[model samples]
Target: MRNENQGTPRRTNRFWVKVAGVGLIAGLIGGGIAIGIGGAIQHHEAVVSTRVPSGSNRAGGTKVNKNKADLNGEATRAYNSVQGAVVSVINKQNVQQDNGILGMFGPTQGDNSSSSSSNGKLETASEGSGVIYKKSGNAAYIVTNNHVVKGSSALQVIMSNGRKVDAQLVGTDAATDLAVLKINSANVTTVAGFGNSNSITAGQDVLAIGSPMGSEYANTVTKGIVSAKNRTLKAGTDGTLTSVIQTDAAINSGNSGGPLINMAGQVIGINSMKLSSDNQGSSIEGMGFAIPSNEVTRVINQIVKHGRVIRPRLGILYTDLANISAKQRQSVLKLPKNVNQGSVIMDVKPGSAAQKAGLKKYDVITKMAGQQIHGLAQLRDILYAHKIGQRISITYYQGGHVHQTTVKLVP
Candidate 1:
């Protein structure tokens, strides 16, 4: 019985060994098939896909192109804000026409055909720029240079949207070179905002918007920086000193009365004029001036309220004492040796404040209103500060003797 049991165990062990060998062969085949399939899939992917560096651009990528957003910067913001408020001012005058009647030698005066249509007046046109600063009820106020509307038989304002409307001259102040006009506010889209010129400093960014050469270039924008905070520029050969804000922005002939825009999208200045050439006939560039918004607000308000700027007038035609030769000073007017800079009274109008105060021709005004007067500009600066009918003291030199008198200012 023991011998039979031992033989049965040997038989069982032999059967299990054969089963293990068959299982090992089948497992190896299955593993090889799985590895081959993975390699084929990976090879297919490598062949079909395109590879690129990490930072490289793709055909359809998610990056922003800043150049395409050129109109999204501060300059664009400022221009966009005020461009709509700017308009072209046209000055139409009835000039005499030149018909050359009876040939060129007929009459010295040209025939009035060109200027005169049927009623014998031909229309001549001049242009500048202006800003719509205020809108009240059915009327909108536009501010421009006084010289622009000077001698205009008719005035027209061309809006940004190409609408032309008649403009009535509200008031004009030649001393400040500012004029106010009114137009129907029917299609007014935007009214420009004002900024405190006192808050802006030199070297700040600025933009000029205007009809540079006419309505053809209306709303043309030029960029620059504030070259100076305050510049005293003479206007109209009168040597009338006007305090202005100097900028490097390009201001052309037709740019006068347009707005000088700041980065905050506010009008800080009014483009007044630019230096065209020096006395030596040298071309000048990058020198442009504007009326400061603070002064503009002050002057325009008075112009709007009154038909003119009611300045306290002493009514004396004077020249700067510095312009007089030292010989003339010591010989004609006989001013004191110590007195050099002041306004020399040339002609005081009859019944004027100066004349009423006993001032006469050749009287050198040394001081006014307790302030030292160096020249006509300084005297005007001080004189305009007082109201009409106010009593002010004046000091003068007559025949090398100093005298004092009180004068009542008048408009």
Candidate 2:
């Protein structure tokens, strides 16, 4: 029960499997084995609300009829508006066949050979959810979590009506855990709209639409309130800081890349990961997070235009100073007695920003752009905050002496 990212691992015989590791955050990607349902596209109109008139009470106060009141009001409308646009994403990978002597001998009598061994076939590696965001020129674009389609040989999209279509990988940004996909727009009748995530306040109603536990539960909708805004979490293996919207919605395995919609039926966030437990192995609940739609729009635009995200690079590998022993800091790095935290440059890329700035190996970086750099992660977080070609100040200790220099960031 250590801190781990959660993605549903592949299971056989309709069983559910969980992936575990040392991280509290769990990506809602389902890797379970499932059967795809085939059918034609079926369109569903948004539900209309019915109004009931209020009656006068004996005390002269207006009394509304409880029995005739619309219980499925905003939530129902919000869900219906985007339900058709939500889809199930399938990640298929090429199953490797055993090349050993036993595998080459083939299955003997009474032996059950794997279906993937019969031919060079692909198998379902994982499943998640996605939202159809845009349609243009016979192609529809989808947005989902990068982990949902990571290491995939091929990807498929299961529409709301159970229609399956091949999806092309447009681009993926692992730092943000977001990916863009392209599919045929012929059967895509609905396109979810983006809302102003920056303006969404805490306690505002929201809806989450996606497949939970695979295509078998596709188009599932859950209601919740915006628990908090601007919640930051350390994402990816590199510990990149990512800001996301926190909610109490029921985002489960297979809901990754799905849309978190507002009461107005506009997508405010893209469901990504959740905190499943504490570092001490205590189970926690109601702590799901989604990528703010504003960031998603920015990243996807660049991905669609460039097939990749272009970010400023420091062109140097470094280790966190906190990870080094005090003896190593003084003996190997030759740092001052008070200097305990920084990034120790390991290698500088040739003809790159660090090299151009006269930075060398063993330089301990203490500050960047006037901000204190405690470790590599903090340095990276500050570095990524600037744009490419921007000049920034860098402070480091060289030969036990402190010095400051300006370096222009490059892409």
Candidate 3:
């Protein structure tokens, strides 16, 4: 079950064929309604309602620095900005997994409709969250997580001002944990603003605004500093994500698709998931992660324009040459045959970008587009930053001679 980030030598690229499919399967696994957002977004009945600490209820106000800026104002502004567009997930027709250890494999939406409107499975609907991207032009696209819309085909979105309407799933990219939905509405209000994720520095204050625990507190805010930037977690695509921002703002089960904001009240990240292991609500201390806005923007534009994202491919299989002496392999990586370390390209897929650029099997690629390709780590990054038509230069070693070539990528 290991993925690309594991550093294990892959025998073939068969793993990718299974990894790339966009999949969603809904089942009967109900959860409590998440509630507690404020006047900005209005949700239906299925929201979780937990009271906040005495001075913290400024509409999902987090624990960010009070001195950094008028943070309370920033939170309120963020709240007001997306409140009307957030919605409660309606999971009445879906079946949630029974309360057991393997429950996560079942469906996830719970009773979101009025509590009194009970259907079978002792649930009505599950509560979730969303954001409206475009307004008053063509159709309003409300963005949420793919998992949220999984179990049920029918969906309902609630605005911050307290209105509910039907929403349709536009498209979802599971690799990045994001989804877009289209809703036909007249003058639908409030679209969230995008901010530069790369500009987020260490110690910069930020907030998480979403329906954690369900829609009760629609714009609930929690504050924290940008813990780190460009962190490569061994979670997906082999450090394939760049400029990924890390924060400790409290994220909960239903917080997916919510916004993480900067002092200027602009979105810098999306609150995707938190590491958790139990039903007692326990999580790793001081640990929370987000999908940087850069990745979000790229995926959104691709989905809106082409119905799916087109990630460029290098089409090569790799393995570490640990068994071979560094002295012998140095020339293999374009480094001196006497140099100390590098990975070996064991095989090249026919018709691949690598093969088309004169990269032959057993040729050790040392650099890509002038950036050092130490292992699968750096190699994945160089190819990821470009699109299908972009060109790049490659440096490799063969026959004790260093050589270079250029490659044009393909989707």
Candidate 4:
């Protein structure tokens, strides 16, 4: 011991250590260490590693700007995730075909004559983006849009490292504009997780990854912001309002069914449609929408179980009841129990849940599940809360007497 308890030497050593720690932190704040930190943190990639991947930077190198780091991270996550989920998709699309009946007119619809190099046997192939939700028995069930792989059932997935595999159709739901697919392949790479759409705030950064007019470029990335939320747009193909996650991300024709990812690489929505002048009135730009992931999970669960998402209809027309003759009553004006309140049962669908439950014309619903019936929106919200097969208790005013009934839901 060289003065083991000496205060002078101990103080000097402690001062140097603090200085070093501060220096390291400062370097990470705005120096090249940030890229390294990002790589490490993502890898936890937060701890330590002997090997650094191609896209990752080294530790204590530099710091990236807040915005830049966020953008870079989002793009990287999307590209990696997209590539991983794309497995074997390219293999299905890029095969050379023969000169057909119209010779130079190209292969006719539903032609699969180019998958083999040795013999003239027909093997099927098609190009589309597939999202991995879960690993089913001997296969992975991926989801995509119907139109992408509609005609031919043959599905292909391309992996991050360029490996390919053939996929199958799981199920489809046309009403909700969603489809589920499955594929069997070894070494399958990624499964995109669902992000909470309800937690999304406006102005948050977002990224869209898709092929878009070029199926070969399967993992192309575009940047944007959460322009709005809970936006109700239309998908003309299905007469229902597409409850969507509106963003400034550029979504083109072929981008449908791709994911809208956040900086953390979590998918918040499914890229569904882009608002074009043809879809709207005037020139619409920077407006794109995605199906909320919450809705996606629900529809997927239904399709996987029942081959369709069963939505029970509560038979009644809102217009049947008269509201207080105020224009705003439909929106802002509150409803009273005996006045502009619940929908009057006008005409019930034959053998519908309402009809079976003894609901009749002019019957006024006063409350639902003990919640006051403000109007149709409130009623719709309450009803939507119940799944098909769930029983509901509703109170209504009819025959000058208050009565309640339990109704079983059906899709």
- True-vs-predicted CA distance for residue 350, candidate 1, Å: 3.0
Assess each prediction's global lDDT (C-alpha) against the native: 0.88, 0.86, 0.68, 0.69
| Candidate 3 structure quality by residue, lDDT tens digits, 1-411 | 767666543634656645543221111111112223332245423233443435645588566655865655765766666555555554335444443233557434455533233235534456677667666566888767666766554777766766667777667776666777788767586677788787789898888877888767776778888888766554332223333567888888777777777877777877666666557866575566777887788788788888877888878877655556655565444446453344577788898888888777777777788887555555766677798898888877776578888888898
Candidate 3 residues lying further than 4 Å off, grouped into runs, are 1-75, 82-127, 136-138, 234-243, 277-283, 319-346, 360-364, 373-378, 398-401
TM-score sort, best first: 1, 2, 3, 4
lDDT of 3: 0.68
TM-score of 4: 0.63
lDDT for model 1, on a 0 to 1 scale? Answer: 0.88
Q: Is candidate 1 or candidate 4 better by lDDT?
A: 1
Task: Pick the lDDT winner.
Answer: 1
lDDT of 4 by residue, 195-307 (tens): 89889999999988776764667677789999997775554255554567889988876677778888877778878778788644788889998877877888788888888
Candidate achieving higher lDDT, 1 or 3: 1
Q: For model 2, how does the per-residue alpha-carbon lDDT over 1-411 read when each residue is reduced to its tens digit?
A: 863434334343225322343122242222121111111111112222333436855587666766977868989988988999999999999887654335566644334544334346999989999999999999999999999999998999999999999999999998889999999999999999999888999999999999999999999999999999978686543466777899999999999999999999999999998888999999989999999898888889889999998989989988888888899888888999998878999999999999888899999999999999865556766787688889999999998999988999889
Error of 4 at 319 (Å): 6.4
**Candidates 1 and 4, the one with greater TM-score:** 1
Residue 184 alpha-carbon offset, candidate 1, angstroms = 1.4
| Candidate 1 Cα deviation (angstroms), residue 182 | 1.0
**Per-model C-alpha RMSD:** 13.4, 29.8, 33.1, 21.4
